[model samples]
Target: MKKHLSIFKLKPLSMLCFTFLILISSCKKEESDPNEQLQDGNSTVITDLAGDTQAAMGSATPGKEARPFYIFLFRLKDQKQIWIRNATDSAQWLKGKDWDLAFTGPYNSEVYVNDKKYRYNPGFEGNAESAVVMLEQQYDLVDQAPSDQVFDASTITKIGWASSASANGWFFYSLSTHIMQAIPNRTYAIRLPDGKYAKLQLINAYKGNPPSVTDLNWPAPYFTFKYYVQQNGSKNLKTK
Candidate 1:
């Protein structure tokens, strides 16, 4: 007697479903990789975090300019970015320690630490103890933060474009070309309000973090930067 043979096969509909599932999986993996590998091979680096992408094209008035530009507030601990619509209301932001860094002023280039006691700061009269100090070293090379005494003695609030010293801030403006460019090798070492330490690298201020932007009308205020926060309450910020 001959034995009967039977074979199971996938139907056309089942084959289609299997292909769709594979495509969905591939898309999810691409979206999940939002971070780049650090040189240290142990730490991950956040990449291309875009800030405010809107531009302040002044109102219909001929001579009157836009009163307030939107402020982009950031928290280093969770890597959260909030856009403040009501730019003038300091009470909302100062109500709590929700923000660590702020991007305000034209093109959202003027950055500040949420130091409440500092006059003219967004957190004025509040309880935040955050302070910022400019570091001359590159972002990846900064292994440690400056001493607390140095942060206590700092007086800088704005860390964006330097009108006087071209190399002082994160970016420089070309007077002849009327273009703004992010200066290379500029990083900020910040003292968080909770006394934690962080180092920030402002890579670009224009859209896509382009290497070279020549047009004055290029989409801007979309800041791209990376930062590392030391969660252990120590100054060891070795990203590389």
Candidate 2:
């Protein structure tokens, strides 16, 4: 037995090499690409707008109500986003200065736009306090324009009657027109502060899993919309 030496014996150097290989393998498994977790594309989904009936009616302060209109912040380059309750009590306004775009609404089914706080009134046009520009719809152009096309804000000057009427507001169930509902496939476009373009289409405005009027959850005024922000610095709707 003393005359034979087995070459198959596990040497200390072999053990060390084996352990080093395992360490390298473990490190590789732990490593991950940073971009893997990031959201791809230039689109975002905003599932809800914070304000309830009491908040919309101006009965309660911005953040004190059960629900409050949200101050949406949209940036194009990196796609940074922020959504907060509109602060009506302060002079700061619901529209943030750093924000490229802002939206407020579902107030009686009417959505309002701050348009970068460009001095637009949310009330009826021709009224002494009416805004210079309001969010309106163009039924004829709906078919003409591509569904994903971006829209110019300069083109949206007047508040359409369908968007401001009683019982038949822009997106309520009582509206006679099907396009007026905040239902799926209804798309809207807007121009950003830097003259860029963006588009939004409703997904779900009701509460609960399936979404229904009976599950409306009035006090919670939830809103959901899919939005796309144009990366190029052009006003062209077709450009991404």
Candidate 3:
């Protein structure tokens, strides 16, 4: 079974303990803000993030200026992926906002999903509740590569961004695959407090599936990632 973080309000002492644990777990030392006049420089085109090793956000579809957090993703009540914006980076369009973290690949794996869901192995592991939150470990996402190259799963990767909030840590969906075999590649382009953009990702990384899935099921609630959206009509980076 996976660990589940109760959303219940913590008492003073419990809250303090949790905070202490978080501090000890984080692995990344904070960095100074990287905001400067962009000068509207020329945007470059990257073939792939994983394969090329040196590509970045360019003039792709709607990810204008390489910002994909504005990139969106969603599902209808019927569970079909919905279009949240008019951008090529649709994957993150609706991200950290209206939806719980879902599988990154397309939903064509419904058969595998259903099979895995109903398997009732009872020994399955991994979930937000059970996620390992090192006090200060840093992380980011991989970019969209060209059709020719693909993201490999063996090296540590990194990226950065001007974020909407102070919260930044490695996020894992316990249901992904095997942890060691799982791919830890995800990139982000965040708008800083000064309206300038930046990028971020994990320090050391991997390319593999989620952890082992022996017996898995849930009770009351399923563990997953939280989302963020603007409460003031305009994009609000404030943490909820």
TM-score winner: 1
Name the lDDT value of residue 47 in candidate 1: 52
Best by lDDT: 1
Instruction: At residue 91, give the lDDT of candidate 3.
Output: 36
**Model 2 Cα displacement at 38 (Å)?**
17
Off by over 4 Å in 1: 1-52, 57-67, 87-89
Measured against the true structure, the TM-scores of the candidates, in listed sequence, are: 0.74, 0.46, 0.19
Task: Give the residue spans of candidate 2 off by over 4 A.
Answer: 1-41, 52-89, 93-96, 100-102, 105-109, 116-119, 122-170, 173-184, 208-211, 216-219, 235-240
Give lDDT tens digits, candidate 2, residues 1-240. 532244236587976787788788777545632222122344565555443435543345554454544444444344455555444522343433344333454342344434432355232231121112222443112322322232332344322224333322235455332222343334456544454455555444443213344432343444455455555654343323
Clashing pairs in 1: 116-123
Each candidate structure's count of clashing pairs: 1, 5, 59
After superposition, the stretches of candidate 3 with alpha carbons farther than 4 Å from their true spots are 1-177, 180-223
lDDT, ranked from best to worst: 1, 2, 3
Q: Write the per-residue lDDT of candidate 1 for residues 1-240, one digit (tens) a residue.
A: 121121125667866787798788778656653233223453334455554543444553433345566677877767777777773555577546898888877777778888878787767777787878888888888999999999888777768787755446787877787667777677789898888998887777776666788887666666667777888999998876
**Model 3 TM-score on a 0 to 1 scale:** 0.19
The CA lDDT of each predicted structure is 0.72, 0.41, 0.24
